[model samples]
Target: MTVHLVGAGPGDPSLLTVAAAELIRQARVLVYDRPSMDAIAALAPADAETHVVGLRRGHRALSQPEVNDLLVELGRRGDVVRLKSGDPFVASRGGEEAVALQNAGIAVNVIPGVSAALAAPAAAGIPLMLRQNSVTATFVDGNDDDEHAEPPDWHALARLGGTLVILTGRGRIRRIAAKLIEGGRAPDTPIAAISAASRASQQVLRGTLSTLPAPLPPPVTFVVGEAAALELTCTSPKAS
Candidate 1:
């Protein structure tokens, strides 16, 4: 049995990779997280067995370990399509699942998709790097579940002086901003938050580190540094 670990892109169904779509179509068992992925999940054939492991309003949510177990069980039956938001390896816990499946002797294939860390900034018209302004781009997970995971060194990050992209940081942005400032970043350093990236309902909020408004919503990506101040996608007025 083989399991296909596919990245579903950000939120737009059209962003799904051709390989991902083809795998879903042939999936005998389909597994995905979050309701936002329903549009992508719908690509599976009518007879495919489906499972939603992410938290939902009324339904019980499965822990990562449980989901891993479930995938192992399903993999024994036939080809399984496991759809993860954004790129499978980008803060999606897909690596852990892959490890679990491997330990269980299941074959696996991984398909890449666009990650929100890149898409959110682009969709909001912010470049992650500019030759003159920013030469480095750092991506970090703002929400860490493992107590053992070394906490991010905000001071070093502030001193790194480049573009910083924080995923899953919506709820703790205010605190994170404070830490950055305490770490030596300028209070007026530009910061932007983008939510529902690439979707019709996407929202972008731009401000300095000290002035960013309250968190927009969950699934937000925060861009910090000089590049955040540039709106490269803005249409210029007709040349006079």
Candidate 2:
């Protein structure tokens, strides 16, 4: 038996890859994270045994060890599908799960999904990179425990001359903005926060590095750069 690790994309069911959809239909045991269930969880077989192992910022429905054990146990019985939001390897902790399953001698397959880093900004009409002002795009996980142990070189990032995409940073935007500005980013550099990205509930908030709008809910994507200033209108920012 094999355990398939699939990406559920950035909360839009339509963004689910064909392979991911098929895997869900074939799953005998469907294990999912928080965001995947919001849209594509129902795609699983009617008889599929579904489990939620959602890991939130301060809450965890199922601990990592428990989830890994569950996957191994289920993998021995039949086809198992582990659905995670965004690319399975992109901050979803799929790598650790994959290693756990491998060590347990279970075959595993990983299916890549559209990352929110790109989709969120695009859905909100923010170009990640522009020929005029941006030549590179950098993605950093603002909430990573490992990252927190060692402070990032904001000054070096400011000197990179590109766009910055920060995922899961809604709670720390104020501090992050200050760091970027201290690193040399202009206080007026455009910044945008997109919440519930790619879903019907999507909301975009516009501001600058030093002048962020009022706080929004979690699961937010923050874009900072000259590119964040563009208003292509794909999705307009609501009034702050």
Pick the TM-score winner.
1
What is the lDDT, from 0 to 100, of the residue 224 in candidate 1? Answer: 97
Q: Candidate 2 on 110-158: residue-level lDDT in tens? A: 9999888988898888888789988899998777456335756667887
Cα lDDT listed for each candidate: 0.88, 0.83
TM-score for each predicted model, relative to the true structure:
0.94, 0.89
What would the per-residue lDDT of candidate 1 be over residues 94-208, giving only the tens digit for each residue?
9999999999999989999999999889878888988999989999988754676887888889988899999987877888899899999999999998888888777788899
Top candidate on lDDT is: 1
Give the local distance difference test score of model 2: 0.83
